[model samples]
Target chain A: MAELWELSAAALRAAIGRGEVSCHEVAQAHLDRCAALDPRVRAFVTLTPGTALAQADHWDAARARGEALPPLAGIPIALKDNFCTRGIRTTCSSKILGDWQPPYDATATRLVREAGCVLLGKTNLDEFAMGSSTENSGLFTTRNPWDLDRVPGGSSGGSAAAVAACMSPLATGSDTGGSIRQPAALCGVVGMKPTYGRVSRYGLVAFASSLDQIGPFARSVEDAALLLQALAVPDPLDSTSLPVEAPDYRAALTGDVRGLRIGVPREYFAEGVHETVRTAVRRALDLFCDLGATVEETSTPHAEYGLACYYIIAPAEASSNLARYDGVRYGIRADNARDVIGMFEETRDLGFGDEVKHRIMLGTYALSAGYYDAYYDKALRVRTLVKQDFERCWERYDVLVAPTSPEVAFRIGEKAGDPLAMKLSDICTIPVNMAGNCAISLPCGFQDGLPIGLQIIGKSLDEATVLRAAHAYEQAANWQPRVPSLSP
Target chain B: MPRLTLAEVEHVALLSRLRLTETEKQKLADDLNVILQQFDRLQAVDTREVPPTAHAMTLTNVFRADTARPSLPRAELLHGAPEARDEFFVVPRVVDTE
Candidate 1:
């Protein structure tokens, strides 16, 4: 049998159910792993060991009393710090929010807690989840579990690294651009972004509201599906939350994709992607073909504009949403401000990081009187064409298969100081956010000892097919997930 | 798209409710210019017929039933406030009486 921390969330739940393992044992094993491994991985921003053990004890008592348990009762899960946990310090890896314990739980956080999952606590992210690399984190940067020198990817880096290192079997992450998928790819774990509106976003620290969707990160496609099943429920609190019922995602992992129509978007293979990463994705396509799924080359021409469009759209939304964080409300305030206007200016200037200010400035400029049509409006129009590109593919395809990222994890600070270069890292995965479609990334193969991700993208609200296809490929490929070897 | 001047950079900062140092303004001007120059490609693409997408998915006004319900206790909500006094948040004076 694998080590206790190495078991999947599904397995951990079953173990607790069967009395083969106490919920306490499972919680302790994972918490111990986090304690041992987190010094190097830096995956967690806050860890609640006492609360975790208390939850485990409650579940163990319920089990001893013969009470039926929630499906995810004893599973340990990490949350991206951006998700508000009622009393937990939910920093989005930013100094702007100073030890803020939100008043209410984010809908997703509430659902996960209700599902009886033991909390492994909040993990780090790029401040406000604005950058592709965790290097933008105002808090400590989370290192890739595969190689400590490399980044784990961001703004969900800590969540990805946590799951990849087995500190926790599952984690919650939010993806505005490639936050979840890119990090999962770099860390050799399975990460998924549900379609916009598929998951409720109420109480999530707003970054790019329209593009942000909560997701799951796990070691396997099945584990990711399990976490998403618990998270993808609708919420009235969030007006944009889909009113439709969620499909049974765990049951969707049927390990078969017979006759499934897979479209290979040619633009995803542009010269911007590293050859080795593209090659690995191509090999995964062949494996899918062998599973009886048909693959055909297609085009999403406007997807090339995704990064540029995303920069405008995301920042524009960010600037507006972030304005709520004034000194008078929650978060920190600047001292020595003489007037209200001075307070707002000084508070934001003092609290926000350089990247946050940069985006805010860019966003403010785009939305300013004269430049509105030139920048924001034009980007929105470009966004429409990008969405149409996916719409066209969906007319004839069940799913789109592509590389999740242009390259594998790079050494920390490799793209630091070069904002454009860092932004370009999200090239492959950003298009899906622009299209508001569901997508999942799983390890297809390795490049130079780092994992390469093969993204299975489904149309909006079509996560069932996405999970089915990724599960089919994962099972067929049977690639063993790797954990980093920490050596002195 | 034209490069942003340092003055325009300062204007943008003020609009964003942020204060930038002189060095920061000069730096932001250069950064924004380089970044915006890349976006200049959009102007060439004729989007005359393209409608903008503010929200990606189809959405309708979501109306909730009108009812009085308990809100989060003000104490819990205001716990993180920089300054609070007697059920109200305290801020620097918004208007001048002098």
Candidate 2:
């Protein structure tokens, strides 16, 4: 029998709902697993065993009293440290705000609490959610469960690693540019970034406000859908929140994708993709065809510009958003500063990592007075063309299929020295973010013992089709049940 | 496009309110130049007639009734401040005592 910690969120919720296991039992099993494996995985920045136990006990008591419960009631979930948790340290893996605790919960945090999900703890990420690898985390790097020497894909690295290692059944992650999907693909799990406004960003620490979105990481597509169902609600606090009603995402997973249109973009499979990853993704496309889906070659011509466009736009916005982190209102203050200018310089110098500084500098240079029209403006225009390219593609196909990353999980420190090489890893995933459409990355196959991700992208607000197609493929593939071997 | 010089990188750091060591500034100049060279590809596309999209979705002025909501309590808001003095955040002096 699989341990409760290893069970999927759907299975755990079903067992808890049926009284086969109490919520407390499920929570304790995961807590115990984390106690044992987290040191190896380093998935969490902070563990809240005490709070998790208490919440689980509350759910158990409610069940004993025969009170109605939410579908996710009693399920344990982790949140990336960027989301603000009331009274809990919400570090973005940056020392600047290492000890800063929020006074109120983010909208997503509050919604999860209302859904009766037990909060396991906060997980690690690239500092300020900036890097493609967790090595940028100021606190500590999270290792891949498949191989400790390899990275687990990042900004959402800790969440993906934790889900892959079975430390939590589900976790929340935010994607600015493939943060959720690339890591999910690398860690061999399910990650989805909803349409830009599908989830509210009321209290998510802004990385690049226009591109950033909160999503879910789970072992199975159904669990990913369930978490999205809880998180996809409108919030008055966030102006970008969509007013549309949240759909029954779980119900959309009918596991029958007959005649579904799948577009394999030539641009995504072009140069730089490893042969093993390309083969795995191509094999997955064949499986989709066998399942009655039509696979066709499509072109999103402007996608090649996605990386350049994102690097410009994201950092440009980041430079502005991060300007709030001066030494005044909250967070760390640099001592021994003679003036405010000196204080701001010293504080940021000590607080931000190299990647963050690089981005801020690039943004400052791009948005500078004379260069704004040349760089930032050009990137924005290219973004329009990119969105239009996707629009044109979607006119012929229901969803686009692509590799989540150019390659599988690479060895730690392999690309650490070259920032450009690290940025190139996001080429396959950034276009989806640039277009502001929904995309999901699921384990399609493995290459040399490392998992490869297959990304399915849908039109704006068309996540139903995206989840439906992913679930259909997932049910047929049966890849979600595979877990990494942690034993030496 | 001109390659970024070390002095240009230092100027950008000054604009960004960040302090970088001399070594980091040189390294940043090299790195930024490489990245900018990659970004130069965007110049090939003709966007003269295209309007720049600042946001993904079509957005307009979003407004709510002008009613004040309860804000976080002063004590709770100041809980994370590095230095506070009687309901106020303390910071370095903005001006020198000449």
Candidate 3:
């Protein structure tokens, strides 16, 4: 059973193609795994076994007719609840949107369906993708597959945990502030946040529009590249989607790390990082050095200010994006309202979680007339300094490598009381989003029996280089044995 | 560091349209105080000459041609609305008129 679950997505695709395993068998096997394990993990908000089997049947029929099938034929993938899927309840794990079934599919979701992938179901998330831990989710908090008590780092916690637990080979995740990579690091899986605008945000329920990017979560770097291939098409539906040539990222994984200049950000290691996590990052860097890569200590001087800028900018945008949920247009509505304002007041207060409401209020204040210059405007200026810091580093190195998070997965309720500590977890990560660069997090080593992730970030649209470095490191380390002690 | 007064927190909550009870307002004041103190660290950085950038890439003149496209059926637009009248979303008066 473990052997079957451990197969890479590429190998699984080959097997399904050769009739070695039928599409129905693949779908049923994953369903069975989810059924047996998901209760303990709580990774999925909704499991659509019926829809999955139907999609699998369509793939099987296409193959039987000897017709050309898509590249990802019959592969099971979990959809993050934030991505809008037509006819399916696309909740962002907020009670306000608990019943909203979007009539449109996000451009990325549509492209994935067109590629013949089976949509397993929508995974859980932090409400509005705001919190670092899934505890902020209105529905269920996703547990790290490695340890039931520990959190799968969130907003994309369920997506990372689903792939980590073998509930699915690949899943989609969106990262605004370490949503994808932090969770992937905690769950011992591969998660990529493509360069901003590389993937479409057309139907993704916006958290921070300027910062949010949709990407793939997978068991291996190559598998992530395959899913990235399926989702990277430019779409007119998203005005922010980049119109650059979509490169063949899968072919770029040459698995050779020789002469690649890897930058170790000096400020990232200065302090606040856990000793165990630092050791793991240092070991990964040493391995890169042994693999013929030149490791250099680089500095993103203004990185210390990232958390400040990200909080202001992300929440400000979130304040605007979430303004649509005034209760009259869609989803949950306050039935007992005496007036429109009452309806909005009652609906949002009851529907949004504490963290979501906190952000909304903070953002509204930040963007308010009196504070805009001091908070939001100044944060934007600091954001420019942070981006320039990265630009200077990119001119000297190929990619920047750092620990994805300062610490391993903490207990579920550990930092739930202190939101500042929660915000600090993304300190090393928020800069990438603010800089609008590409980054991938892959398992590097284990510390105290939990997995640690080494993050590789590249200049804008340098996902191929990031993937190559990660793939080479993953192959050399072969650290797949460190799957967290997660039981279904 | 910017200090958030209780009155300011109340005003912000009103702007965000969240009707907070007195107890909730007190709790938010405490939370917002800690968050705002963290922002004080940013004042230490010298960004005096740095130009603010909202986007990383240089994109310009992104306007699409002003050609009118087929519109969504007005009936369908109101299909998901909680309350609709005559193929339009029905709402209480937002701006009071004499």
**Position A214, candidate 2: lDDT:** 97
For residues A1-488, write the lDDT of model 2, one tens digit per residue. 67899899999988888789999999999999999999999999999998899999999988888899987999999999999999999889998885888998999999988988999999999998998879899999999998888999899999999999999999999999999999999999999999999999999999999999999999999999999999999888999998889878988999888899899999999999888888889999999999999999988999999999999999999999899888677788889788889999999998888998999999999999888998999999999999999999888999999999999998999997786888988999999888899999999988777899999999999988999999999999886437998886
True lDDT of residue A42, candidate 1: 97
The parts of candidate 1 lying over 4 Å away from their true place are: none
Over 4 Å off in model 3, which ranges?
A: A1-4, A482-488, B65-77, B92-98
Docking verdict class for candidate 1? high
Regions more than 4 Å wrong, model 2: B96-98
Q: What clash count goes with each model?
A: 0, 0, 4
TM-score of each: 0.99, 0.99, 0.97
DockQ of each model against the real complex? 0.86, 0.83, 0.64
Question: Over the stretch A297-384, how does candidate 1's per-residue lDDT look in tens digits?
Answer: 9999988888899989999999999998778878899988999999999989888899999999999999999999999999999999
Chain B TM-score, model 1, reads 0.92
Residue A142 displacement in candidate 3 (angstroms): 0.9
lDDT of each: 0.91, 0.92, 0.89
Of models 1 and 3, which has the larger DockQ?
Answer: 1
- The stretch of ten residues in a row with the least summed lDDT in candidate 2 chain A is A479-488
Clashes of 1: 0
lDDT of 3 by residue, B1-98 (tens): 66888899888987898978888888899998899888988888777898888886666645667888986456654666677888667776677677
